[model samples]
Target: MLELHLNFCNLVEIPDAIGNLHFLEILNLMGNNFSTLPSLKELSKLQLLNLKDCRQLKYLPNLPSRTDLSSKRSLPESFSSKKDPWAFERFYDYMEAGLNTFGCPELIELERCTSTALSWTLQILLQVHYQYILPSLWNIPFPSIISSIIGGSEIPSWFNNHREGMGSIITIDESPLMHKGNNCIALACCVVFGPPASRRKAPPIIHSLNHVSVPFLCAEDRITEDHLWWFYVTSGSHIWSTKYENLKLQFHIIRESDIESWSFHGKKYGYRWVYEKDLEESNLTMICSR
Candidate 1:
C-alpha cells in the first residue's frame, strides 16, 4: 500500500510495524490520539506525512528524507487511448489552453511538472552525487519535488521576482541574476487562480476535458488554489546563465481569431478555445517569482 489515512480515528498510539510498510509514501495521522510518533526510519519510500491537528503529538522521528524518482509509478496498462480520462486528446487540449487550470492542476500534469523539475534539480543533485561518485555509481535516477509549503499568502521563497495584477511585464535582463541565480538551469511558474463557479461553467475546467485530473479534483467543491508549473529551459548560452532572456508570462489574454497575428506571445497561431461559454472566466496575473 502507498497511502494510509488514519485521521480523526481517536487512536492513542500507532504500532511500530507500520514502519515496515516500506512502500508507503503518504501517511496522514491528523486528529489522531497520540503525543509521540514512533520511529519511522524504515519507511524509505515515504514522501508525505501529514500530522495536522494531532493535538497530542509532541515528538517525531528522524523521518526519511530521500525525495527521488524511486517511487515513480509507470502509467498503468489499463490505460486506454480513447476511452480513458487521460487520453492524448485531452492532454493536447490542456496544452493548447496554455496549460492553466482552475486551481490545482490534475495530477497528470504532475508528469510534466516532474520532468521539468528533474532538469532544475539535475544541475544541483549531480554535484551532490559527484562527491560520492564511487559509492553511488549512478544507479538511481534523480527526481525532485521541492516542497515550498509556507504559512499564509506570501510568494514562495524560491521565486526571483513577483508582482500583482495581470498584463504586467516583468522584464528579465539578458544576463539576469549575474551574481545570484544558479545559472538559470530551469524556470518555475506559480499562478493563483479559481473562484466558485456553477457546474455549468466549472465542469469544463474543473472536469477538464483531458480527464487526467478527474481523480484529483473534487467535483463538488470550488478550486480556489494556487497552480504551479516548471519548465526545463536553456539559457541563451552555457546551458543556463546568470543573464536570462525576457521571461514574459502573459496571463488572461482574451484572444480572438485575429489576436494571434500581432501577438508575439500567441506564437502566430489562432486561439479557438475562447468561444466556449466562460461561466467563470478567471482574472489571471503572473507574478514572476522566478
Candidate 2:
C-alpha cells in the first residue's frame, strides 16, 4: 500500500509489518495511544509522517530523507536533533507567500514576537492545518467533524445554536439506525476573541486545555474588516465514545505571560459546540456512519 492512516484508533503499538511496506509514502498516526513507533527504516518512499496527538510518544525510528514530520508537541531528542534546521525557514517563506496573496498582515506581527521563529511559526501554522485547511482537504475520502470560533459579537450562520456567554454545554442524542453502524468521528468548535489591543499586556502563550478536555484539532485565521479573533477546530479530534447516550462538548479559554522570559500577549476565548444532526455537506461530508 502507498498510504496508511490509523488515526484515532486507540492503538497501543504498531506492528513491525508496517515497515515491510516499502512503497508506503504517507503514514498518519494522529490521536493514537502509542508511545513509540516501529522502525520505518525499510520504507524508503515514506514521505509524510503525521503524529499530531500521540501524547505518550517518546521515540521515533529513523525515517527516509525526504520525509516531512508534523506533531503538536515535541518529539524525542534523537529525532528533533536530526531535523533540517532550515525546514522552518522554508516553511515560513511559504506561509508568508500564501498569506500575502490574501493580504494577511498578521505574519509580520507574528515574526516580530519570536526569538525562536521556527517553534513559534510551527505552533501557529499547525492551528491553520487542523482548524481550517484539514477539513477542506480531507472531505472526499474521509468525512470529518471540523469546527471553529472567532472573536465576534454575533454567531456565524454555520452553527446551529449559540449562547451569550463564554461557555455552554451541547448534547446530541443518537439514532436507532446508528446501532447497526455509525461514522461518528469527531467534534470541533470556533472561538472568537474580544479585541487584540486588550490582549497586548499579556505574555506569549502556549495553548492548553482545561475542564473535561478532549483531544483537539485546532486552527486560527484573521478575517479582515471583521476585527474578531477566531479559532476553529477544523478536523479530526474531540473524540467521544459510541456507548454514551449524549455527546457533551465543553470549552474554555485562559491567558498567561512570562515577562522575565518572553514579551508576548496571550488571549483565550471560550466556546462550545451545539450538536446539529442533519449537517449540510457542500463543504464537509458529515457522514454518520463509516
TM-score of each: 0.38, 0.28
| Residue pairs with clashing backbones, model 1 | 35-56, 159-289, 160-290, 161-288, 175-243, 176-243, 176-244
Give the poorly placed runs of model 1, Cα more than 4 Å off: 1-16, 26-42, 48-63, 71-75, 81-151, 166-184, 190-245, 248-290
lDDT by residue for model 1 over 93-203, one digit each (tens)? Answer: 211111122232222333333322322233323222322121133332222222211111333333445545322122233333342344333333433233233322221
Error of model 2, residue 33, in angstroms: 45
Across 26-86, the per-residue lDDT of candidate 2 in tens digits comes to 5767667776678776765554455655556555454432222222222222322136643
Judge candidate 2 against the unseen true structure and give its global Cα lDDT, from 0 to 1.
Answer: 0.35
Clashes (backbone N, CA, C under 3 Å), per candidate, total 7, 21
